[model samples]
Target chain A: MAVDGTRPYGAYPPGSETEQVGIMTSTVTILYFAALREQIGRESQVATLPAGGMTVTALLAQLGQQDPRVAGAFAAEPRLRVAINQTLGGLEQIVRPGDEVAVFPPMTGG
Target chain B: MSVPGAGVPKVGSPEMGSPELDSLGAGIHVAVQEAPFDTASEIARLSALSDRTGGVGLFFGQVRGGNGLVSLTLEHYPGMTEKILHALAHEAVQRFGLLGCTLIHRVGTLRVGEAIVFVGASAAHRGAALDATAFLIDRLKTGAPFWKKEEFADGHASWVAAREEDEHAARAWSQDTPPPA
Candidate 1:
């Protein structure tokens, strides 16, 4: 089950000074849907972020590096949208601990 | 005027409790389920919900055949999809003066020609009903958080890409679509 966390994207107050500088890390749940799921070969996974946390864009970059296929898949399309806790999110959205992040292609549902 | 099957349980009512409406809210009913739904019964239920309803317009979207298509699978963001559908339905009811609205979208593997989605809108006049129906379907295509992937008889599968045309269709409704007299 995906954990629900408070705080919307871009609303994360920079963590306490001690928590910054990679002193503390947070676990975030990342979910894949549609083609991205196929490319990632899994539905969801837990990833640890650097102490200060990272933007959705940076997380995607890090995920891409971890899996070249992910990098290729995202690099192929610029329209991929992300959601934080099921709400439409932007690349700059912050991903904090316990947040469920979903990345997928533009919606094709009717 | 009474609809043919208006006696059926109204959607979201105690007798008709469905996963569609986790919490009974007024005027809008949304379901994102994997099971096939009875379109006639759903329409009947929607029509029965409001005494002032003059017409009920419904749209059923089915999987298209061809392109060697064997089956199609739909995936959605669970919690978000329901919220998004509710938002769309609420907007339709307000903008089109609808007495009630119903939206049900099926997920999971589905065969060609199977109903993939349905939208029903009830209003005091045919104009509102008809326009709201179109608006709901158009907006649902692009606004909802669902994705489709098609599999071919030859064992090949591909994700369905969002079409520019669908966005255009949804956008058309944004400019205050006039209700036909």
Candidate 2:
């Protein structure tokens, strides 16, 4: 079965799947800045995440493979931090569709 | 304008006596300016702002002619920029018993010799005030998310490289032990 990206992670919302059949999938927003932004070209972009299960690290790996610059950026591992909707989260955290994930260098700001 | 803590009236206050000099007195004021700063006004504001505090510390960071670079532009992450600045100010106040402090950082296009940042601090003694001023500026330069794009005289523009030295300066502040009484 082709997994629909629009469906939220885990169990689908009650009855909504049946109510709206064949709806095009939606995409999530990813924000990049500084070196990351320069490499990505665009400051922010919308992407569709694979269904079933995907950890933050896994998602990052996929992004890296898609863009060589992104791959080089995350090669430093812990040097880069990830935030979901502005709050810091670990790599294992599950990301849902429509979530805004921001990737940037370790914060040096006061 | 009137002095910060003084009973005098504010600079622009209608009740003030002279148009040139307001109740706040004639000297120290802090402003994030688009045009080049007036050194005379800055000196006046600094002098007027001082009172019981025996020491006044100030830092003026200007955009350097980056190897013959004529123009520079600063970019910052909107909401996050202001949030970080406010947090830094609060931290400075808590760490040092500062009488008063002012920080003004300009964002956007700027030319060489134009002031990019201003940090002012006042305390009971000079030592504390000077240290606090240094600490604030050091932290702001390294920790802040602002990025600078330098346009050289050759018409080429590039993002300024992040300096490890700045990080070291900020790290020193974290390691410092409180001074002895």
Candidate 3:
């Protein structure tokens, strides 16, 4: 079964998440900033990934479930950008343990 | 301090004293900090490092006062910030034959009328130096991992939104394939 609030688009069945009961999960550091930080009420938090590995999109889905406000932010997908360990990253990027992931709005710097 | 060029490719001829080689020390210096910098002194230092430098082009981005913004705050990804700036400077040096380059961006809370960014490029000719300076500034505006939040005089605050015009400006460099000689 998919973790409640963690699955976006319902790509996988909810109960399927339990199939990995014997498998190991990975940890990822997720950071929020600016408006996201304000909305989420924290700068950073650690998230657990599925047994195999989670992509940035999957991570967002997981985080979106953790809080209604976070879920609302993701409603504006494609408008949000993320960074994996400080470099600009995309949804397809696989997240591994010890990786620091940052989610924020589009940059407006010169 | 030296700018770390991680993913940025090495550029400029060996004789040009690129910081990439390190033997002659780094000609490209980048800094991302909370403290303000002495713009004139910094430009002077970059100019003195490269003997072949004939023209030094400089640009300063400042927070405009009376523009409804009372204060501004900049946020960036730590390690990635310097790396990206170094990469931009590296490309400028290699693409335009720059003898040296310097980039500085300030973070934390800043008041209206304070300088926010500084970019300088030095080359044997004015064209190269000027072009490189433009390239660095334009790219930094869109490519860097920095974000800006503006606080109005009335206490209202909002994140500065990314503009399509800025993206269009950055895309020009990529679209101009083969680059003008």
Judging by DockQ against the true structure, name the best candidate: 1
lDDT of 3: 0.72
Q: What is the C-alpha lDDT of each candidate?
A: 0.75, 0.61, 0.72
Two-chain DockQ for model 1: 0.30
lDDT score of residue B150 within candidate 3: 92
Q: Which pairs clash inside model 1?
A: none
Task: List per-candidate RMSD values in Å.
Answer: 9.4, 12.0, 8.5
Which has the higher DockQ value, candidate number 2 or candidate number 3? 3
Predicted chain B of candidate 3, TM-score versus the true chain B: 0.84
Using Cα atoms, each model's DockQ against the true complex is 0.30, 0.09, 0.29
What tens-digit string does per-residue lDDT give for candidate 3 at B1-181?
1223332334344543544555322688888777889988988987797678787989999887776889898877655677688777777877887778989998878899898999999888988887778778878988887788899988899888889988876777775452353
Best by TM-score: 3
Worst 10 residues of 2 chain A by lDDT: A7-16
In Å, what is the interface RMSD of model 1?
Answer: 13.4
How far out, in Å, is residue B128 in model 3?
Answer: 1.2
> All candidates' TM-scores?
0.79, 0.64, 0.81
Ranking by TM-score: 3, 1, 2
Name the best candidate (by lDDT). Answer: 1
Clashing residue pairs found in predicted model 3: A1-A14, A1-A15, A1-A16, A1-A17, A2-A14, B19-B26
